[model samples]
Target chain A: MKKVLFLFVVLFGSCAKLDNNLYNNDNKIKEYKLDDYTGEQDFILDDSYHIPPGLVTLLTLPSQADGESSSTEIKAIYIGDVSKINSDTVLLYCHGNKDHMDFYWQRAKLLAHVNGKNKYGVLMMDYRGYGLSKGKPGEKGMYADVSACMQWLKNNGLNNNRLIIYGFSMGTASACELSANAAPMLPDKIILEAPFASVAVMIQDASQLNMPADYFTDLKIDNAEEIKKCDQPLLWLHGKSDNFLNYKTHGQAVYKNYHGRYKESILIEGADHGQVPSQMGFENYLKLIGSFIRKP
Target chain B: MRLIRFICIFLFLIFICFCSPTQLVKPLQKGQRAAAITYGGPLIKFAGAPIPIPFTTLGFSYGLTSKITGYASLHTTSLIFGNLQTTVGGLFSLYEQENKFGLTVSPAIQTAYNIRNKTGFRIWPTLDLNAYYHPLQKPSFVYIGANSWFELSSLRAHNEPQANHIIPNIHAGYMLVKTKWQHQFEIKYLGLGIPNLPGVVDYIGISHKGALGIYYSLIRKF
Candidate 1:
């Protein structure tokens, strides 16, 4: 027993903690490169949705993980007049994994045009460790960062009934989590684009083996299960042929699990993980989202 | 999920290597006993460069009869991280032409259980057939074989119907025998006829189909 214990210690002594940052791609970039960026992109705006440089305001909000002092400041960008946020219908756009805010700026800008350009105020933020945000990124920190953003809007006059939360890819966890159990303010509705089912699904899909979900220590971002607890309306959009996260196993699974107030899903044919918006057509995309958000 | 990257590596290893690389294709004499250890996994671009996952396993083999060998192994790499896994099997010699060539079949079962996730026991049935040649007429030889595993559970994430059931691998290897030790090297084309791209792991495969795997083994005889 002593020898076995020694062997166990020696073998796992170097194993690192499963930090929440493992689920995010914040370490992939050293700085934020917005429109000037030229890398892999799912949606590219050809200046049609472009707002003047001053139109989008970059603001830093103080936020922290659950239980810790909320001192970490995160970067957020907003479209429309800040003075009118309290009276505005705001769309909180959470981005996918990879790089920083610049990668999803086009997507956020696209959401700003959901019901005609600049009609609904759109706010998107870089969770800690993403873009110019301080500290590192993790699951709890994600919720806190979003709560801080919503708090800022509430302080400026926005009400819960006019707030909509949207998540893409990795951002889906925060979206579903916050909506399922929001602290400062609950979103009126939730929108998920290319959302995954859960960590269990991802492991089983990639491996074809039924590795126990508990084997993954700290990584517990399960949107499929969390959506079940969400009573708010949900709008799910997924590509028919998503290679990263399969539509049949991931998106459909999440869509089917949500027993919410109101729910609808769109399966875009010939589209993969990152091609949902482009393949769905920008006009149709905006119309679908606008109609859903505009609905009772 | 970076953890998905870890799980994918483990899954890739299941198709390529739940046992030792020296699945010799030749049965040992009655009363013969040996111990073995193996290392290596499907190559992936981890932390920037291409490298094997360094999965490790320790195994023991015993000749129950002249034509039947019993073997079992533990995936120590996984055990170190809290998941306990083992593969158990028997080698049945089907045919042999003295020392020139021989055929053998190994039917195995792999089971894994996590200490934290108690009751979450998972099992997969595996089978391998190898045909080996003794080129030097001594203890050194080469072999080629096909290995496969069956995923019995029909439910995937969120109870989705599991579409895929069997994963196949084609492998070839060489073993060098010494007085009391043996050294082996093997290469496998894992998940044969299956596409292996658009994933977190950059598997080294052929035409984007199936992953190429390399393994090394050391064995001690008693």
Candidate 2:
């Protein structure tokens, strides 16, 4: 009996950890405290906050059933007038790894204040295993999380014509996956910031070696492949000196491969990872983004 | 006496829970075959709590001659950046004093790759030295060993590319032989801090402290 129990322990412990090697949710707390606000709800912008004049709407969208993850709602923060959902263009923002939505609050605020004051609606959500969402993060699970949020916008009466998709770093994989295969709900325009081409290309760039695709894992997020199939208007922004993901190998490669209807790229000279927007200066960055959105 | 030795080995296992040093291989008789599984991982302290990250290995060995044994093994860890290794090696006895002391040497080749990253591969040439001592008329033995490997490729971890070329591990253990059943427990100290080229730094742990590791295995000889 003891030997049997020991074998059982060893076999049971062989299961892989979900957070291992991928999701870095060191602060996994769902109740994010932003200026004394807890949970997702209404936050009145007082005089102290530099954000545009608008009410920040916070809520959790119901999760859809996925075989790979436990069903749980995703937490999101939308900055803008809720009444403008029908008229204004909405940016579905996908953030990078580490931490949660709280870390991305400032970016959301800046994006909302972009095109004059309160001119755009920005919606950002935490992927599963991030923030208050309950589930392990995997390739399929993350895709499901973004799809649910997109559905929430659709249920609120927003469609592809008035919706734009924006992805940053690791989030670029999610955005590209959606834009490539999600035809019925395809986004009108796509913006990629410091994006990697794919996990395979990333490895080749980092290690400078040619290896098989399934040498380590089958979790292939080939944005290069996805971008080729996507025909949306695209804007690619990258820092020339990005240390984590090389601009020459990853960002530029994806931009070159993109055979979209319309495309543009801005390779900042001195910017590093996570510093493009600030390095481009707030006013000039807003101007570039405003022009892209306003173009017919 | 048995209880005291068990306690000592248990304490030593905790002390070296942060490393994955090599294990001592006991040579078997000609035509003998054996199988074993080992669980080992580095103990990383997170928010003041010691969490053990498991790396598991499964192996099988066969005696080609009375003094030579050959083996193959596969190993994996929980970290995504950590690569899975497949290793093949052979053990050769230098000198033997059946009831007193024995010395052996092993040299092996290990190939590492990741299932998720799917890009690079690292090759390691390793050498293991082991010495065993058995008191007269006793079935229990005390052993000491050291493993050295040359890192020959650039490996990625913590989202950074690190090129390390040297790694060494030291270990000690106890073993008991009971008919066809053999039990072994080991504690190891893996050398951390592989110096990189100028202007390059590699992260081995969350802090500056070295890693320790432990291993236990039950071998079924046939």
Candidate 3:
């Protein structure tokens, strides 16, 4: 009797049909509007209460992959000393699922200020449906947006040797996908923060049960599977106390699967989810990141 | 004692199979029929009191009249090991106006079973009320409703259990087909409890219903 009851509870709890009503509304996509702020005056500090010093420039990258009629726009922030663009290494930062690029502006600034004498450029962009970007955000739309920004960087004379990719949470999947399909030019290094093993694994972890991976979102980008194909140096950072994305299940899986030249894993003791870098103090975290990048 | 246990088991099985508030109503016409079903589990939270328990239910319904309909549903809850409670009831629609407005009333009876004492039976009485609206030209609609239940049996812990609750259901969907067939999705907050566990406590509950079923007439013609 106990066994039967346990089975019943598990069956119902694990696979409750997704509440389609929450997403059925047609108003999921809204036009992006810039928040009122002084021109480049520590916007991140104002928005998220984090103070990092750098020259922040707002840029828009147009997406033409969806044909001439497509009006999709990609909103991005370029952070660094604008005068030293020709010699500085560029970091393309991709944020997690919840908010827009503005949420990570402070982090980008810290990345730029890591090696003070040696300048670095950091560019963070909003996926479609987030912030000032156009249209609803989905798997295909996000890939197009990132590709457009990469092309924009290439056109402006930034090449593989001077380019680094940093992705967090959902953006880690995008970073891995791009790295696997890199053109003749590839990124110098890839950093994943709070990365997941794969889409199927994430869904199963969230549901707390076994669900058929095939029935999930039609576009499946398995980062764990894709990371094996890339030879780039990979860095993964995760917090041990993260309850939302279990460290052992998602983060550990990626670390175990990456068969690359150089792979580094940092497990913060008390950090939770997106709080690792911030909790460690910006300067100390920046120093660690700088040493990792400049290591021979 | 053995005979009494057999009779109780047979009656309980009959209640599980037949008695319910949301059930399919046979249509009067031949082409298509429209019906609605509603079922809820036991209250997990009661104001400052929180109880860790398992409560669940399943309801299926079919349409009978073009504007007027009928339904039946079943509710089951497990308060403790070896003691499972169940409620069975049926409902009828008084009137409906071309999906514009509707009024319905339901009556039900509930029973409890003790696995240790298979011969015991306890029954109770329940009532429910509903009102629904859908504009002819607009893509928006609303439904306001309520329900009550009263225990009729003389069990130590089961006497005169009364509940008064309300439901406000709203829907917005493009008419994929004319009145006969339309793809519809609805968001409803069925407020099922009073100030102190009066109905069913549902502050953190939200229901989203979407269906791709066809709507046809039975008795009443346009």
Candidate 4:
């Protein structure tokens, strides 16, 4: 009876699943709007947050050919001088689930001004299947895609201590995954903004049922668990009223689970999933992030 | 346990993709037994194609007295996903007159335990209220009713206050009764009067509030 029951559970558990391909909106990109590109933005920046004419460079990164992830080329935008990457404190910005890099350009440009305009470098990439990248998006592909850009940064002079990974919304998965696993290399520090706890948490919260995520998806992303394995200094920020990924359930879980070297939490009131920076006041946001990096 | 405002954002779960319609609209005769198989759920746009999530169930009911009927059913689809989902309830005839209008209420407890995760044991108190009209002397009835599934846990993953406590659904059905067999066809508007907007299922709802669910049942009496 035990054997039969176990077999039944296994069969039933794997019976149905929502197609994994539906998760990515990669094909939704019209064009990569950097500066002059005006559609909709997080916030229209004053000339202060602008990246000078030639500072932003677009490049294609090569992801590692590992069994867990597909080998693919990735599109990334670097916002700083390539010649000074060795000495600069570079921040790798992992974007949320949305169209492409263009939608996140305003956020990226704002980060470039952290501490001061172009005080440090920043790199943003559209994971595979997003933007002009190749191949389909998968859970493993997300981390591997970020690793590709990391490889680019490493080959061009960025290293462990100077590398900071920042994730927002869906981007937090790859950021926390890569940092926890420390596969390509370890980051000096990590920042998560409005990070969801896990696929199970999202589905359960969304449905208001005790639904196991495996019932609908095969994706096994768990930032709450992943953060525990990370030993680097962490800065976690979330909006108090984040409607999309409720901070209390998602971000708070990740924040509390971090047994890292150090950690900080910033909960801004009335901000939503994508409005943390604007809600914190760009300067205060940058100051908070900049101070966290400069600490110890 | 804190009661938080619930929003049915995930529209596809119903067709609760858990609450269907009233299984026993009218109490069976004393000492009678019946079994049923049901299928169909909310219509969702998947890959640009409208698909009715095929939620299935197998249920059995027995009448203890002329005025009361008891039932229990397993959600076959949920089981396939390693979630043991079942609802057990008793149907009570509230108001009745032979071959005329009748009101019945089935208050059931919906239970789900995840065998795969080995966690997520949840029991929801559910109520189904229906008023039916026996339009024909040949044993057929048309009914309209409302269903509510109450979430017992006021907290969800990460100790967050569960926003949704009572999930509401409205349905209409027609039952055809024969001597040995019966069939029921029900159409449910799950999550009624709630703003289930920014939908995940692309639910075919009214004013972006709720999903349209259709159910079919076949019952054999013994």
Which is the leading candidate under DockQ? Answer: 1
lDDT of 2 at B65: 92
Best by lDDT: 4
Q: Rate the local accuracy (lDDT) of all candidates.
A: 0.78, 0.67, 0.52, 0.80
User: Could you tell which candidate, 2 or 4, scores higher by TM-score?
Assistant: 4
> How would you encode candidate 2's per-residue C-alpha lDDT over A1-296 as one tens digit per residue?
99974564455334442223445553446476644544332123344336633467777876654574446677887787777677778888998875678766666666776677678888888887787776666677778788887887887778898888899988899889999995336788898998988765554432233333344345768888789888988999998867667786678778887897999999998887777877887677778887888777
Model 1, B1-222: lDDT tens per residue? 454465454444343233334454577788999898988777665565666667678888999999999998877776655666788999999998887899999998888766544556788888999999999687788999999888887877677787678888889999888899998888887778776544444556788777777788898889
* CA deviation > 4 Å runs, candidate 2: A1-14, A17-21, A26-49, A65-72, A133-138, A155-157, A199-220, A240-243, A246-253, A269-272, B1-71, B76-85, B90-202, B205-222
Fnat of candidate 1 is 0.24
How well is each residue in A100-218 modelled by candidate 4, as lDDT tens digits? 78878999999998888898899999988887887777777878889888888888988899999999988999899999986766889999999989877867755666556665556
* Decoy 4 TM-score against native: 0.77
Considering only N, C-alpha and C atoms within 3 Å, which residue pairs clash in candidate 1? Answer: A86-A157, A86-A158
Model 2 lDDT, residue A131, Cα: 79
Candidate 3 docking DockQ: 0.02
In candidate 3 the C-alpha lDDT for residue A211 amounts to: 27
By DockQ rank, best first, the candidates go: 1, 4, 2, 3
Candidate 4 lDDT: 0.80
lDDT of 3 by residue, A114-151 (tens): 67723688878887777677777676677677777787
How much is B43 displaced in model 1, in angstroms?
3.5
| Every model's TM-score on chain B | 0.88, 0.73, 0.45, 0.88
DockQ of prediction 1: 0.36
lDDT by residue (tens digit), candidate 4, B4-62: 00112244343344446338898999999999998777766655566566677889999
DockQ for the candidates, in order: 0.36, 0.07, 0.02, 0.26
